[model samples]
Target: MSPTLVFGVIAAYFILLLVISYFTSRKADNNTFFTADKQSPWFLVAFGMVGATLSGVTFISVPGEVGNTNWTYLQFVMGNMVGYAVIALVLIPLFYRLKLVSIYEYLRDRFGQNSYLSGASFFLISQTIGASFRLFLAALVLQLAFFDAFGIPFYVTVLTNIALIWLYTFRGGIKTIVWTDTLQTTFLLLAVVVSIIMIINHLDLSVPQVFTVVTESDLSTIFEWDWRSGQNFFKTFLAGIFITIAMNGLDQNIMQKNLTISNTGDAQKNILWFSITFFIATVLFLSLGVLLYEYATTQGIALPGRSDELYPMLALNHFGAVAGIVFLLGIIAAAFSSADSALTALTTSFCVDILGLKRKEHKNQNRTRMLVHIGFTILMFFVIIIFSSLNDSSVVSAVFKVAGFTYGPLLGLFAFGLLSKRTVNDKFVPFVVILSPVISIILDYNSEAWLNGYKFGFEILIVNAAITCLGLFLLKGNGKNERLNEAENL
Candidate 1:
């Protein structure tokens, strides 16, 4: 594809997002900034979340994974369904009953002020690093595809791209994000669908032939029953539930949008729709990978070392100008949809939870809040550049390793709140939560060294969760009535 056409399509796509932002941000205020006045349609949120859920990581990563990982990632995606169902039935009702602007506020009510901060702080660290790294990855790929020709420095490219996101999101917060995410997701889904059809025709394979090749090619098998392995069936399903509960049900970034819908019932319905749509959409992308691989095998193209680049590289080289353009659009749609929302959620959580901006009723709250929003956006700009420059695959994996620690404490905090009644020693709560992960990290690192051949994967989440639950037990005061201790008699 010509650089002119690729750049033109991408520019037009950004303009479309800006238009959505403009309409949504008009007359935006504290209520709109925080929760969209609890008036956003649940169906819109359900559809919008599809984009946020996939993000740039899944957009490029999952399809590529099909080629390299033999399509076992679908097991995790299927596990996500069970996770979402649990979120709808249990977490949504609790958040609704509390009338929470920041979901972490429940931590204070259930445990103490320190617990609240502990939860939010973990979220800020994890989301900031995770979002910035995701943006950096997408920016690097975009730079390779488009800006390398013009000799544009990667940092300049990163700044310009993130600046565009901040431009639209600085006003409306979650209100604007809900609508923009939906629009971006629509474009993203359309791009994927179009690419699939084009690739199928290009390969001259009928639908049955495509499925036959994929099923026969050793990439479509789903079950791995080995408990010790990374992609094991039970581990994937259980990890799916835990990850969904911790990441989606507990984290402010995702749940904030879930809270924006009108009521508990609406939010619950939206969760259901979001799960079903997300699963189907993921399957579509994975199938696209199957087709792409089949086409590459027929054509004999060289694959990149990192599986993540397979989709873009193939589209640029083999699928010609039209598919190349579609590929770029899909990447932009996927990257911005999640990146923009992450920025908004970061702003929302900071302004509301950590900063206590949401509790204020001052007329100046809007002005002050805008400053906070812009400040974080700028912070993210530099953070993304630093992470992009490091570019070490294991270094990125380490960030995820540290970030994984946050989820266990989160899961323990919520589970203790809902499932137990003991009054926790507020002073020791932070120590317990913080120490659990640090201890787990030490143990996890030494396990392989001491045991000689022990390995870990997503199971780290399970171990972290267990340590958190243990910490909670240690913090409970003796002779205190369990929070649920009295309820069982009812």
Candidate 2:
């Protein structure tokens, strides 16, 4: 592939996103920005969610992961299904009853102001770092692919990419995110399909043969059966269920989309369908990883040093120019789908939850909202730059680790309110909330050193949840107000 051609295709793709941004942002006010006036189609939200669920990390990491753990990550997919089911059945009802602009508001209503702020604060921390890391991964590729001229630093690349995401997402918020995510998901899946076909042709493998090769090969195993092993089937399955419930079902970014539905029933349906489709999509990506490994082995080509680059480099090397262009577009789609949504959700949550900016405020309210958007954009810019500068090999691991602690507190706060009849002492709640993650992090760090390789993985969320429950138990608000508080809880 000529550099000029690759450059042109990538440039043209981003230009299209900018054009979509312009159209989506034009008529967007706070209502349109945050919830799309509650007019967004549930089906579109589900469709677009496919892309958002699988970011650049999945795009690159899944195929690479095939080589490492015998494709055991599929166990986590089962866990995801369980998670989504809990979200649809349990969490959605609570969220709908609250009629919330920010899901965290339910915490305050049920528990107290401290619990509310605690949940929102944790979201701000988790999404900021998680989103930044996603952009950081994409920026590294873009820098290596296009901006390696004159020795431009990776930090500059990270900042530049985040700025672009902010520019488009700032105006329309969730309104633009819904439509843009749908388009991005389309591109991402198309890229995957095209790449799979190209790889199959290159391998001279029929569809059955492709499956045959994958199944007969070492990469198709689903269960480790070893209790202590990473990616053990049962553990991954249970973890997936909890993760979806805790992370997506309860978290603001994903539930924000669900809440955009006109009614609870429709939102529930959307989540059900999204979970089913999400599981199918995970299988497809894993299959692609298996095929890529087969293709590389047949051609006697050494895989890239970093497993993360397996699919990208394979497309570039074997399928040549056309596939390379497709790969770049897919990467952009995969990266922006989540990045734009993350930025928008963060802005929406901050304005309404933290700053008390009402979605139904006066016309001049746009100024405050826009400032909030810009503030988050700037924050994303700096965070990505710092992440890229550090160039941590375990960036994704770190991102999920943060989620385990931060989102567990979110889950705990929500559960404490939903399942219990007690009102948390508002003043002490914040300290408990703050201490949960700090304690989880400390435990996570020391646990591995003291207990050997028995470090926390996804199950650390369980620990965080337990600590939060313990904190809630310590609070003994008067029973006289319990019924009233529980009634108002989200």
User: At residue 362, what lDDT does model 2 achieve?
Assistant: 71
lDDT of 2 at 201: 89
* lDDT tens per residue, model 2, 60-169: 77777788776787888888887787788777887777678888887776766767777898899888888877777677777767777547777677767777787778
Question: For each candidate, what is the lDDT?
Answer: 0.78, 0.79
User: Which number leads on TM-score?
Assistant: 2
Q: Which regions of candidate 2 are displaced past 4 Å?
A: 391-396, 448-455, 482-490
Off by over 4 Å in 1: 359-363, 394-402, 449-452, 478-490
Q: Put down candidate 1 lDDT per residue, 1-490, tens digits, no spaces.
A: 6667768987888898889889998887888878887889999999999988887777777777776666777787777899899899888888887788988888877667788888888788777887887777668767877788899998888988898988888877788889988887887787788778777787787889877877787777777876656677777777777777887898788898998987889899999989999999988888887877777787887777877777878777677777777777777878887788788778878887787886444678877788878887888888887776666543324444655676778888778777777677777888877887887788777876775656565557777878887888877766654332222231
How much lDDT does candidate 2 score?
0.79
Query: What is the TM-score of candidate 2?
Result: 0.94
